[model samples]
Target: MKNFKSEIENPIISKDILDLENKIALYYEGKIDEARFRSLRLARGIYGQRQFGVQMIRIKLPYGKVSSEQLHRIAEVSDTYSRGRLHITTRQDIQIHHVSLEKTPELWAELEQDEITLREACGNTVRNVTASETAGIDIKEPFDVSPYAQAVFEFFLRNPICQEMGRKFKISFSGTDEDTALSFINDLGFIAKLNKGEKGFKILIGGGLGSQPRPANVMCEFISVDKIIPLIEAVLRVFDRYGERTKRSRARLKFLVQQIGLVAFVKLVKEEHKALSNQTYKIDTAKFDKEIILPEIKIPSVKIKNMETYNLWKETNVIPQKQQGLFAIGIKIHLGNFYTDKARLLAHLIKKYAANELRLSLRQNILIRHVKEELLPFFYVELKKLGFAETGYNSLVDITACPGTDTCNLGIASSTGITKELEKVLTNEYPHYKNNKDITIKISGCMNACGQHAMAHIGFQGMAIKSGNLVAPALQVLLGGGIIGNGKGRFSDKVIKIPSKRGPEALRYLLNDFETKKEDKETFLKYYDRKQEHYFYKLLKPLADTSNLQQKDFMDWGSNEQYINTVGIGECAGVVIDLVATLLFESEEKIEQAKASLQLNQFSDSAYYAYTSMVNTAKALLLTKEEKTNTQAIIITEFEKLFSDKIKLETPFSEFVYQIKKNKPSKEFTTKYVQDAAFFYKKVTTYRTKTRSNGNNQQA
Candidate 1:
């Protein structure tokens, strides 16, 4: 992977952190006290979501490795401050959520005890560095990538210029060709390979997992270990100056990479990369290489006569260890989760059993390596001590999910909860489906696309819908998404929009339909794509109140078709993950009040107190349940007053009429910007607004 010698020697910290600590310390000390400091501080650096408030703390897990004590401590953090969960991100770092504002100092203090920190976790900064979670264990790997990921992470952790980059930065390393590391999904990816018999990395540039998803581009062949950091630095330099910052959605490196063309992007990176070091790269290659060595592994004396199940699991899980008779074991954890206590116990067991070797996977799972075949049973016994090592390593729950509403603020749907629900319901109803392979289901709470839904074979996006009078929401089903091969991948196709309550049933129906009608060895997407146009419209025909599903029949209620069928106020409009993020992050007290009184996030309780004078302040309008006799003008009158302070409707409607008549007309909202940022946020949060952005502020 991309190893540089000095990377781990001295880890970096952001200058912004120093400033934040001082400011927060002042806030905590009762000096310079302002009521808004808490919210401002939370929004500026701390992002809140479903569980505990999350800080997006990115712990540097070199080659996705962590110590036994560190694992326990992470669990402690989760249990103490978060929703008692730890997420192994696709980039091979750990993302903890639901961290409290009051706990920042303590959290930072505790993390430092284990050599971890939350500095530079978010903002326009370089994020946690990643590598092939299977780095050294996979036999095909030329060398251990742990040290390289560490080196890069260390070398640039808080590099002064990285404090305020033009946009977010991502980097990844893969130790083998099997590419379980997912190098292609980062802004810069390095895959271990040989150039003219010299071991190094083939560089891929400009890939990401956001709204505008793009598989990376190959830039050059086998950049030497010493040169990796320089190349990264060069790329960062170009991105820092050239990446678009005018729009937050268009601010990622992928946009610049695409805009400039991959060849040109590579050329720019190379020029800046070689400039600072005069093309030699200042890293001490020998020192970095010396730290990594082949470790001796023990062979188990016990031999297994029966190896069928083991062999099958091995086909999917185990990998080559450079040392003969030694194999890397991949222990799948459904949704990449294990208890902290369990993790600690496993840590102790693996440290003793596998000679201090550990690896994590992109799918939020854990991998243990360097074990002998004979010791499999012993490892299994130990794993059982931690609630793992059950049959079916790649079982249905071995599903992968992003930290959607579970921790992220931008999520639309509750991916974790929905994932859990899907697992529970699917297992109870269709247990046999667990054995099915290549059936990937990805859920994104929002269209910020953090969940990588755009690349899943079966993807679901959370969205809001206006059913007659209810503020009901639904998920937009997608098919045919995945990494095609190498770094090339396909985006999912938008198929049908189904109600949120019907998600599990919808999934079951889709899978059943696919299995029944599919030809021999036919994939889900193949069946889906063949009958694409006809399938969705036909199924959803009954679900629409006045769908006008006909391509030519458009909604004329709003100024444009885009704003039609919308409710009064909600976020995650025409989206899913965003709604999940909004609903999941609140405290129990806050949530109960919201549901009981129909309130918004920050203003829920206060809004109820102020607006309770008028009864039925919050009403759900489900269009599908209504009659066609509902006239447009009558419906508009009732809807217009729903957002007002009085119980009587005509007064509000009259005011709205007067206000609209007073304003001069310009372009429609679909083609123009409106100073309704707050109103816009509500539409998305409430799932009521029909107007939508084409996702990410970045428009091609």
Candidate 2:
């Protein structure tokens, strides 16, 4: 493969691409451990798909903003390196699957030319920073959150504090109290606010969705915008130090905050304040507040063949921007899957007639902003040709679904197949509900909730049900979950489990009941809450009966073969390995990174890198004794217990490690911390060598 390292303009990004190339070579040559390589690749946005060899590349777009040129670049890269398909994720990322792992470096280089990145899009690092797709143009917003979201994305892209954490961290920004960005379900969520003429944010912390969904607790009702980034840095530092590690199921920031009560978590976060690089980082919104330049094109006259259909589309798919005389056109992408051929055409259309930009919505749709009202018909005509003019934008027919069994390794059933069936049912049987934005439907292939099923008005989680000796794919129906605005949200309760093939019928029953019994202005969630879980369970109980199962029930949706309940090891967060050599090797890498950051005069980053190095070295040694090295806190304490006598330090081991939070990350302190880390690493390495020399070591 040709190396594109020299073509990358940013030296840091160039080094990143070169490092990936080197790592790939090392992995192929069996120099790096498989688990270690998996972690490395995943952090770079190279994910292993359900298909064995090909990888999925997640392109991280901050706040979902994409320029026409960037879109063209992405489409070109897709055509060149992938199968010419793009899948927009719920986190506002673009994913291209069936890519060769070896070609990823080059593909990433191509993307970098357009100022797009794949860094930290996955793995045990900060994922994509998402926000409201209508951020800059929301009428109800106190201010646009695009600049804040972009600032956060830039600050943490390759920051040492969050890299190699126990699990992935997620952050989001909402432009208004409407909470369209779903702030209640992220690690750190910010809602734009204005208090007494000062710009601020309402903060939510430690929210997540999986088998067990937890709503975020209010960290504060309001905090100045300048303090938000610092607060988030402190939170990440706390999570990295104290969050669970060994058990993948309980490694999220939510689990950490839940384990130690929210009060204690907040205290720990406050303790990290001094260690942060900036006490107050102000986000500049001047660039984002600039006047949007719309294309100056003569309005094309297009006669509407179906005036009623165009009107329905206008009602459902068009959003009036806060800016006068301009609009935002919503394209309801089916299953979030669109091809590069159409992508190119859309790119051209937006560049020629619109604002040369679009936002990939959180619900896996496209929002073309800054369109003139006169251009609506032209957009409709163009989008319809590409099958992007589906009605029900953010409505009942606009279903949110994960890639499920199609490409995801963790998927237990076909979420897309069932989504298609339900859409058919909704469009054909209940067309009146097309514009019903009150109800939300989401599907996840498994309990991991990548589809965010737990937070939907109507949710389905894929599972397996047994009938005698045979197993069939099933959907666990959940109800009564939705955003309640202003950082408050609800989680759905599992009502019943039905065969996967009957998913459409399950939707039909729920929607029918909701349609008939709901009060005049009652939302789906309100109706669900009134009816309650038991009532829905009773209503859908007939589909749960397995005694009268047909052969088709044995098969999963969109599959010809009978269901076998096959599930591979999930890399939603990369696998955690305890290989001692790999750990030591990683420790050395961290030390090198610390030194590099120190040279660059990044004091806090250097200190954190050194801290990670020390912890990693201690964990490596502790693993030799077969000790439980779960969290960094545990690693620190256990190291003192087991190796305090063996390797004497100037101060107690805990005190030495705990200096990170005790003092500010000054240049002098960072230099000393790096030295201390190096000394500790040397002592541990010498101790291990002596133990091995005397034949006292149990393992290498």
Candidate 3:
């Protein structure tokens, strides 16, 4: 025992964090709306929303591993600095709602003290890095991904070039193909892989979920962690320079990945990787003994022969542990919620008894790893006392839902309330489903799809209705959704809408239908797929169509708000281009203009000039510099430029300047272009900014 030993320590937040916070606070409060405020807000994790009076703040949690102390701090921050609640986003990041414009700087400083940050969490930058919690510990895992995830997080924490990219970039790492880390659906994903004796990762780039969803592309076969930064830098730089700068919506890396094949994209990334600094993957594992060790556990003695209850838990609740004889137990939390006191207690209990090792699952649940099998029964009793002893993990009652109407401003319906009721109804009646396999029932409060209801087995979406005097909210039924293998899955389709009060009944009908319609142990999804949606909806006749309101899909018909006649006395007296007659009437003027531009040449169609002019006018009015534009909409501009001379019956519009690539002399243009111009023209002009300027007037 010569003195050849080592020591370990936890890293603290950088001192510059405080100084940076001060500078940001001065800028935000003083209305110093210069380059500095813009720069810092991107760094401080502040995101401006389209809603009139609110903002969303994203908090970065490295490796999906968070401290109980940090959780409590966040809870406090929500109660004091925000809307008294914290939102767990799909990206494994926490979002704070309705934060006052002034308190942000203080909030960032507090997070800095806890070694957490908002820097580059949002705003066209490298978002929070995600990794599998079982990175090194799960035997199913090929290798530990924590080091690689940590490396990427630190490498791009504030890298200047990659800081403000085309849009936010999401990076994820998975140790196994089981892929709880959602590597397949990220902007950059690395699923662990090995060949021969060399251990490495499978790289994917460009996946995202929004209005436009696309899966990522695999760039590397198996690149060592040593080149992770350079590889990422190369990919992002290509996205920055070549991505569509004109359109905000289509500017995601996926669009570029589509335009340039994955092979070409990886080639560019490999090129950029050569220019960046070469970093080492060599870490001294001995340096972080505390970080690597499991949380301390309070070993209790429950010496009994029958371990049936414990066995059930081991079968359902526990996940495989990479270390022999150790397992990770999943403590299912309904709707990813725990009160302040409950959270605080769990933190201490975990640190003292569960080896200080806790991880959150994608299903909005918690997991405690490395608990000894013999001490498990005693641990189960403790967990029981904490009111968390529900041994059924991934059972019916273990449903996940977004906060919905309880908190979110964008919520269309009540998710937490519905999830709670749905969970109770299923657990009370559908106990047979656990053996059937893990059925995920997710609920989204609104069309924004926060719950990712798109990926659940039986998804419920919240929607509102305008009935005779009152407008009530209700849940819409979406069946047949879940993970097939890895992250490749399809979204559930909305078969019908059910009133909130009748949700339990509707769900029961679905479960009952599953039993009767299924053939010899066929899974629920298979039956639903074969039976088809109409057959299923036919079962619940009126319940399926709860509103019974003639649903013509607002987009297909038209905006109800546009029907309001405000062109006469509105504050902003812009023309309301609603009816087809309005467009057809414009033909009279365009024909007259066409007579002048044609120079004695008789035009075949007079309505063509009129239609083109109307569309160009509408396009000009809709497109403006005060707002951001997407490249997908550039065709409208191109149309305007192509029909300029023919569209001489136009008022001076600034939007026409950039539209249409070249105003060449031509005569072979068809009326289809004119019709397209008119079709898109009406949709663009009818759009209105429904907002209130006074911040205090808005409600969540």
Best-to-worst order by TM-score is: 2, 3, 1
The lDDT of model 1 is 0.56
Tens-place lDDT per residue, model 2, 287-380, is 8888988767789998889989999999999989899999999999999999999999999998999888899998999999999988899889
Shift in Å, residue 553, candidate 1: 27
TM-score result, candidate 2: 0.98
lDDT of 3 by residue, 515-543 (tens): 77789968778887898888867876667
Q: Residue 27 deviation, candidate 3, in Å? A: 5.6
Task: Give the TM-scores of the predictions, in the order they appear.
Answer: 0.67, 0.98, 0.69
TM-score of 3: 0.69
Model 3 alpha-carbon drift over 4 Å, by segment = 1-30, 33-43, 47-57, 68-87, 95-101, 259-264, 270-274, 279-298, 302-311, 434-436, 465-476, 497-502, 537-541, 546-700
Pitting candidate 1 against candidate 3, the one with the higher lDDT is: 3
The whole-model lDDT of each prediction reads 0.56, 0.92, 0.60
Candidate 1, 1-700: lDDT as tens digits: 1121123233223333344556677776876344334333432335444444345444546557776667777777777776666667655567666566656655555565667666555556676677766676566677777677777877766453354454667777777775555667788888777777766788877787766677887887667777787677667756754665445566678888788798787676655532232244444445434532333556445444447644555566666677677777667676665666676677777666675657676666677776776676666555655666544444444556665544555655556656776777767887666556566777776666655677777777766655554434456777777655444556777777765556676667777777788889887667767878468556543443333233212322111223223322111111111122222222222324333333222221222221111111121221212311122223334545444442233355334222222332222321111222223234323443221243333453
Choose 1 or 2, whichever is better by lDDT.
2
Candidate 1 TM-score versus the reference: 0.67
